[model samples]
Target: ADGAAYERALERHAGLAKPPGSLGRLEDLGARLAAIAGRCPPPIPSSPAVVVAAADHGVHAQGVSDWPQEVTAAMVETVAAGGAAVNAIARTVGARVEVVDVGTLRLGPVPGGVHDERVRSGTRDLAVEPAMTIEECRAAIGAGARVAAELIDGGADLLVTGEVGIGNTTASAALIAAFTGAEPAEVTGKGANLDHERTPHKVEIVRTALARHAADTSVEARGSLGTLASLGGLEHAALVGVMLAGAAARIPVIVDGVITGAAALAAVALCPDVAGYLIAGHTSAEPGGRSLPDRLGEPALLDLRLRLGEGTGALLAVPLVQAAARVLTDMVTLADVTKTA
Candidate 1:
């Protein structure tokens, strides 16, 4: 990304026919697009693609979420068949949807639309063991990077991160609490809008995971990768890979809700510059979702109390991102207005 291009975009915004700052954050968003694309008026992001990475968490056995782990595979099938909310939203937004089986525990026969690169059946029980070995974590990250590169090379101008795993929110909360030092109670939320009756148990699950991985919490000692390997879900690790690869490719990556937020924390921890490459699509109702923007220094574009994680929130914000870039390129300049006058 070109720092000079960003400055030039700000100048161009001031010269637009509309009153200065009329577009509010849209103007800033346009400038960021310019910086990322290295153009005064960045190309309107087209060929948008959303990757829904599916996996299972061994911690589901802890009774944190009422949703059975089998639902993860079922939802992956739903996504492949275009029956899910994300598929409908992606269709409406003219974005392509691809399901990636990174570490699903019991996926059935995969559809042609699904990408199969499973690192393992699913992650080990974080409550009892490390979610994955460091080697397994590296494999999942590598798989995510490869997927991102393939998508970009296949003409995807914009990318959105998504996920599907029945107990992922529990894993997401645990990862957030571990990295951010937020209490488990502070980060855990009503995942899948499950009954609040189980919230206490959920918090305790996260608390247990944190205690088990205590040595990995020291940033100087264990580092972000260690924290991620110790606490993150396979989907979360893969999302971090997608984010890092997107930044490397200089393509903007829109982050979804809490699951994606946990991934972004790990990604930024790995490479701080990746923060500049991210755009928060929406803040999930979950606590981590709300605090995520504060952690990344990038405010979300929307907040409609969305907690569905299959990239639905992020896909909804795609048109807004496109509009920002379009306005920069299509709107007339003050010089033109003065001439017409």
Candidate 2:
């Protein structure tokens, strides 16, 4: 991000017709948009896009979620057909939706309209072994970066992170715990409404995975990649790639719920500057969702108690993000009003 542009935006906001700081977070968001665009008056993002990275988790076998792994692929097909909540939200916000099969298990033919970038069929159970080989994890990240680059080349000015994976919350919780050093019990929460009876079991599963991968995740190891390979879902790795790519291009990246939040943690581990490019779309109801942003030092823009992934929460925030930039570009300065008077 351009620090000079950010400072200029803050000065411009103070000079706007409205009282200083009256716009609240919108003012801050506008400055951030300027910082991202390297100008005091950034262009409002008109071509926003959301990349929904779909994948499956071997941890489903651990009974962490009530939803079957098949739901991951089924939801991918639904999103491709424009029948899912994400599609509707994206449409409402005038943002395009792109679904990528980063590691979704192929029960049969892959659906049309979904990008075929599968690094593997699905990840192995993290509790018993590494979720993916280091090579596979890197491949997934590359796939995500490629997709983000393609969309940017296609004129997408803003990117939103989304994902569809049934057992992914288990992986997300594990990733959050690993990066934030938060206990599994503190980060883990009901995913897809996992029954209260199973919540304890889910927490235990995260604990077990973290314990098994302690050496790889330790600070002395400096093993962010290894940590992700051990505990992250394929979609998580891909989302990390998307964030890194967006940051590299100086574009804003709106992060969705806990799953994408976990990916953001990994992305920050890889490149701390990625944090400056991230905008938390909402405060997810999930425990990790709330904690993840706090760890990144980026407060969420909204709190609708949303936990359904697919970038729905972040898509809903697209309008707010666009409005923020417009404030800086279109709003009149206090001097204008005084001159008119």
Candidate 3:
């Protein structure tokens, strides 16, 4: 992203026919698009792609979510078949949905149409032990980076983060708590509609994980890899990779919900510059969703109280992102207005 282009965009927005700042955040978004494109009028993203990284969590054994772990692989298959919510939403925005079995637990061949980049069958239970070894965490991150590179090489101008994994939110909460120093109760939420009775247990699970991995979460600890390996799911690690790759390529990476938000924090921890390329697609209904964006220092593009992950919220925000760029390219300048007058 070019600082000069961003300043140029701000000047261009002021010279547009509309009153100064009338477009509000849309104007800000347009300027950001310009910076990412390194031009005053950024090209409207024509090939937005959502990479839905699917995995399972051994934390499901702790009964943190209402949905069973098998639902993770099942949802991956549904995503591959184009029957999931993300696929329908992607169609509306003319975006492509790519499902990656980054750590899904399946004994057979990978689902058709899904990319095979499994770091492991699934993550170990975080409440009892580290979710992934450092090597496993790095491998998942590499898988995510590879996927992002392939999509970009294939002409995806914008990248959206998505994930599917039962009990993953527990891991998300743990990661958020680890990175942000937020308490378990503050970051934890009922995942997959888990009953109120179980929500408390979910919070406790996050607390236990954080307590067990206190050394890894310390500010003076080696780096984010330890914290992530201790509390993040494989999909979470993979999404971190995607964000880093997109940032390295100087493209926008739209993040979805709380789960991806945790990954974004991990990514920023690994590479602070990665924060510059992130766009929060939406803030979900979850409590952590509200704080995640604040931690990222990026306000979400939408707030529909949506909690469903699957990249649906981010997909819905794609058209809005395109519109932001279109505003710069399509709207008439005040000079044009004067000429017509």
C-alpha TM-score for every candidate: 0.96, 0.97, 0.96
Model 2, range 53-137, lDDT digits (tens) per residue?
Answer: 9999999999888777788899999999999999999999999999999988886767888899999999999998899888899
RMSD of each: 1.8, 1.7, 1.8
User: What C-alpha root-mean-square deviation, in Å, does candidate 2 show against the real structure?
Assistant: 1.7
Model 3 lDDT per residue over 1-341, tens place? 68899999999999999899999989989988888878889888999999999899988899888877788999999999999999999999999999999998888889789999998999998988888988899999999999999999999999999999988888999989888888889888886864677889999989888878874554433478888998999999999989988988878999999999999999988888787788899998888896657975667989998898988888889988999999998888888889988
Better model by lDDT: candidate 1 vs candidate 3: 3
Considering only N, C-alpha and C atoms within 3 Å, which residue pairs clash in candidate 3?
none
Off by over 4 Å in 1: 216-221
Q: What are the per-residue Cα lDDT tens digits for candidate 1 across 61-104?
A: 88878877888888998999999999999999999998899988
Q: Which of the numbered candidates is closest to the native, going by highest lDDT?
A: 2
Poorest lDDT segment (10 consecutive residues) of candidate 1: 215-224
How much lDDT does candidate 3 score? Answer: 0.89
Shift of residue 64 alpha carbon in model 3, Å: 0.9
In candidate 2, which residue ranges exceed 4 Å CA deviation? 215-222
Give lDDT per model, in order.
Answer: 0.87, 0.91, 0.89
